[model samples]
Target: MTLRRLHSLQQWLKEKDVAYAFIQGKANLFYLTGFRCEPHERLVSLLVFQDNEPCLIAPNMETSLICQSGWNYPIIGYSDSEDPWRLISTHLSSLEIVGSNLAVEKELLSVARAEQIKALSPELALLNCEDTIMKLRLIKNDKEIAILKEAAKLADFGVEVGVHALNTGRTEMEILAMIEYELKRKGIREMSFGTLVLSGEQSANPHGKPKMKSIEKGELVLFDLGVVLEGYCSDITRTVAFGNISTEQEKIYETVLTAQEATLSLCRKGTVLGDLDRKARSIITDAGYGAYFPHRIGHGLGVEVHELPSLNENNQDQLQVGMTFTIEPGIYVPKVGGVRIEDDVLITEDGYECLTHYPKELLVVKP
Candidate 1:
């Protein structure tokens, strides 16, 4: 799979007349090389050439792990005492790749790193390859979809754990810990992002942090989280009432659910990506909760929790088959709490498939 992806990227480089591609993003590295690593402050990159075989650069300690990941290409491992950029320059010179146009992910490469790369050869023109890379990753293959389905199942399990752990006096952090602990027990080493267990007014903050505040009755508890499985990701958000919620809370939940469903109904091939968001926003606006519905309707979900094809009112991109993303419609009213319904969706040739199977109906958990 990685070799096939590399071949596609190399073809793009040749078509664009670029000689080399310096891929530095961890996700991009894993997508093209099958080796996933969090190098932190250390440098880890994949250099793909239009003609020559690609090579991977990483910290010396992780070289074995990279090979174990099925990467048979040449690898350059740097020690702490060595300057990686200098080594990279020497390696490029050895490969006779100096003074050639190199494509790099401008969004991921820092100014310092770019300068170091430029210093390697004054004649090298740095071109941005982010768009090409994104286009390549936008569509999911059958294998990727299968892995995503499994990841979504784990996300459903996570929500189940959160709902079961909910109690009147339990702190948000406590419930969050329980969810992560259970996932760890299931062999999940990392979450796509931080697990959010916001309750009551805290949920109104959208991206609020889980605090020590105890979840109380008559308030909504929101679980916004995803697990990283096999280098892919799954994101899901489901809000439930602690006990008997007020009439207004019920209205909010139902409205959000309705909006989400309406948006998801349009997830088919040839549908405008932005139209989905506009449909949900229109419903929310007509229901007089437009102002409360901040943020985009959803985001593309795959190697990263947030990737491409952002679901907003202005983007005019059309939906395509094998595309996986989230359709989350939320309404957040301060002091009154918030309600968000999120589901991972896949655009099919005929229609769409909702990868997440967790119940979306409002569940009033008895305190």
Candidate 2:
């Protein structure tokens, strides 16, 4: 199952004129090799040549696991004495005859490692392979969407538990703790990213972490979180007012909600990504809060929390059917508070479908 996908990837790389490609980042390694290990100990990598399908370079201890998986590629084990980076030169000697193009993950490779590769392969031309991998991953197949759907359900379950746990006396830190505990109890994987539980004035900060302050009335609480299921990820953010009477707070909430709903309604196949972002931004800007709506509308959500085909102003990609992503529009006012309504959408030939069905309207839970 994994080999077929990898072989297709290598073929695409060849078509892109990428002859010698390296995969060092754990995310890319896991994509190529179905096996995953901690980030520090293993330091596993794969070197895929032009004609060859793919080959993994890893520590000797992990050979048994790789072999047991019955993968299609050869598992070449390296020792501590033989440097992994230098192993590139050993593999590229074949490419020398072919005079191949070498590429690596731009975001993952460190400056030092990149310098080494540049020096070692002075003969071969180097290019960015990250885009190649990202484009392939943008459109999910049936199996991939099924995994994400399950993950979304788990995230919804966690959010339900969090809403019930948001008592008047509980602290933001306490609710964050409960979320972690519930996810762990259900055998859910750790967060692909950090969990956020911000309350009151703290909600003004987009990525605020949980604090020790107790939950209070007349304040908005923002819970930005997700859960991983079967190695796939789900992300959702909901804002609720514990207790409120101010017209301004309600206005802000309603305006942001309207903007998000407008975007969701406009999503469909053949829509330009930048145009999609404009739909949401235009609504919020017309409400006389243009400056408050900062940041891109949303981003692609996938195996790694962020992926390609971003729903931003600079995206040149067109929205194709079978692509899965998020539509989150927010209004932030420093020191006052903020509201963000996000939902994951899957593109279809007919239009776009919202995978995240947990209430688009704001859920106001009393404190």
The local distance difference test score of each candidate is: 0.92, 0.78
Candidate 1, 192-263: lDDT as tens digits: 999999999999989999999999989999999999999999999999999999999999999999999888
Q: What is the TM-score (0 to 1) of candidate 1? A: 0.98
- Give candidate 2's error at residue 208 in angstroms: 1.5
Residue 321 C-alpha lDDT in model 2: 89
Candidate 2 off by > 4 Å: 64-70, 79-82, 86-97
What tens digits encode model 2's per-residue C-alpha lDDT throughout 289-326?
Answer: 88988888888877777776788987877898888888
